[model samples]
Target: MDHIRPLPAYLVQRYHGWRATSFAENRSWYRRLADEGQRPRAMVISCCDSRVHVTSIFGAEQGEFFIHRNIANLVPPYEPDGDHHGTSAAVEFAVTSLKVAHLIVLGHSRCGGVQGCYHMCSGHAPELDEKTSFVGRWMDILRPGFARLPEGDDATRQQALEFEAVKVSLENLMTFPFIAERVESGDLSLHGLWNDIAEGGLMALDPRDGSFHPV
Candidate 1:
């Protein structure tokens, strides 16, 4: 306890402001949520980038979305070799327990993780190639995506990798037996999306054509 510090001044101030305004206004709703537990209809997997606001984009209220954010928003194929699997556990809970109807993987333009992956795959970043680099190891999941990138400049190719991040995650998600069973039974659906951060434009993947269309 002595080693830990209190909340930063800004965060504390923000908490006070929220408690006075939003929390106060939604007192009853918050209480109901606590009493009844959550029943979110969808689970969204998004990037750890602060610019990617999943709740703001969808205008989601607290308790309305079950969100899981990570580097590159990647989902490794189901590997039950008894290791720490945060993303898999979250998915399992969302599908098998929460029974969320939709699972969405949201990727964005100018993602640092994706960019790192591009450089790593290009052999330009030897540091990230080291076994000790967690980001490097994680970005390995996007290697398949990088191998098939379209011919273009770095910017174009990077953006393509961003979309690939979403596609890879969508594919890996199906490797889960629970998710596969639910999808097969029509009880669950999967979606892949890409967001242009500065432009605020969204693109949805047409799985049939393997192309993204504006949404």
Candidate 2:
């Protein structure tokens, strides 16, 4: 066995204690939820980053929000193939089946998938050929946005390009028929967000200013 750390064990025991108390006091709350059905208010589209957990960030309980995570948190244009479409399938289930009122695209700083896209577009990445990683295929969806970036190799340009990827995903979200219909009917709202892990702050896209604003 690996080294036994006290921190994780301590956290687990304390967390279970809290959970037990909560469950005891609100046992009917869970039973009532089973009797009824899930009626979450929002759906979150996020990255498959270990550092960014939706339930932890939103302080959500068990059945509060519908969450879907994928490489780079991309929302591809609806195109059905025989292949398994995990992200798109989750979105369809959340929007069509659950009928969530809000769809939040949560982007964060220092995303490895986004960084891989940068390296691939910059021609710095080696040819993987038949050994392509999942990030390669996932970042392929953002190729258009990457190609649209101005020629540069500065840190500022790289950061800007990363944000551009998120903007691209926001636009791609509109490609879904159900999402578009809901937006048109004012039944659903789509929001894009950028979380600064270092600063512990959030920036929301402001159409008026054409920039991200503090949230």
Candidate 3:
């Protein structure tokens, strides 16, 4: 007697097709990937926004990028407490373990988390419901972005703060020892990106011009 594995019929069909493709491409592709380990060329810190997927935007093959996602794509300064430090752990693994050469901090337009941060900063922090809501707490990492903004109306200020959060996170990335070492030694380079999901626009910051250009 043989044990029967359980899986969705559609998934089983897809898996079979994928397995056939893999077998034709490389007979031992799974063995190779497992033995060789993940060798990603870049590490991307991006927002949890469903529309701003890194793999689709970058057209990267599977296992070609080390990805980390959080609210507003923040990189908090390294704190040596009992804090979970999920983002820090990802950065450490990408830099120290994977030795990825490139790092990208991605931001996007119309982000609900960024809007929530703006509302919290406007003396409305207490109004946010504490239960079943992690956005308020998760957005604390972007506090510096609000501080950097000039006093203005809600919409103007929120938009400015949202973009500034990307800069803040990029700055925070330097606080990690491994990241800083690699950046200073020219082993790693960091990039900032803004994806306008609604407009279908992809803009990447240009170091030479200090401006974002369409991709």
Candidate 4:
């Protein structure tokens, strides 16, 4: 793959810095992890947004959290079609093999993916309506969330859909038999979180009222 370039100089420098300090300090821990394997207690599904740092937000140590990031941090309904379902595969592995104690779906404000979904569903993004558009097809998962949002201005509707996306993911996670079983048996728990990137604020979904509160 001649097209594939080497790591950028800045990233290389950052890696070296981390290797010299954090990796150096945790050398033994790293080795131990390699030998024994990772046993992360939680599986975090979050957006692929660079600004949203899941581990840093939770102050999680290496091997402490299993993270899977996607365009909108979505979990599709359980479909054993035997196709290439990346997100579903990750969820299955986390629940069945990793046996994670918790599964968290994290959403954020000003998400481009969510905005795209809003536009597509609201008839504002005609290009995404094409059958060949991967993003459009994938964003179908959020359409139900978009439908749940009340009529409002573009900004308000976008924010509402963002919250609904997390709720949608949580509901989809339950569609997985293993996940639902674990939840019923008290072996696993599910959580939804929304992050405000600009304000550096986090709100957690309350199961009682189905509302988000500051965390």
Candidate that would win on TM-score: 1
The backbone clash count of each candidate, in order, is: 0, 0, 0, 0
lDDT score at residue 200, model 1, on the 0-100 scale: 96
TM-score of 4: 0.97
Question: By summed lDDT, which 10 consecutive residues of candidate 2 come out lowest?
Answer: 126-135
The models' CA-based lDDT, in order, is: 0.95, 0.81, 0.83, 0.94
Clashing pairs in model 2, backbone N/Cα/C closer than 3 A: none
Clashing pairs in 3: none
lDDT of 1 by residue, 60-135 (tens): 9989899999999999999999999889999999999999999999999899999999999999999999999999
For model 3, how does the per-residue alpha-carbon lDDT over 109-173 read when each residue is reduced to its tens digit? Answer: 98888888888876676654364567777777778888878777887788677677788888888
Instruction: Output the better candidate (3/4) by TM-score.
Output: 4
lDDT of 4 by residue, 54-155 (tens): 988888899999999998899999999989999999999999999999999999989999999999998989999999999999999999998789887989
User: Which candidate, 1 or 3, has the higher TM-score?
Assistant: 1
lDDT of 4: 0.94
Per-prediction TM-score: 0.98, 0.84, 0.81, 0.97
Give the higher-TM-score candidate: 1 or 4. Answer: 1
- Top lDDT prediction, candidate number: 1
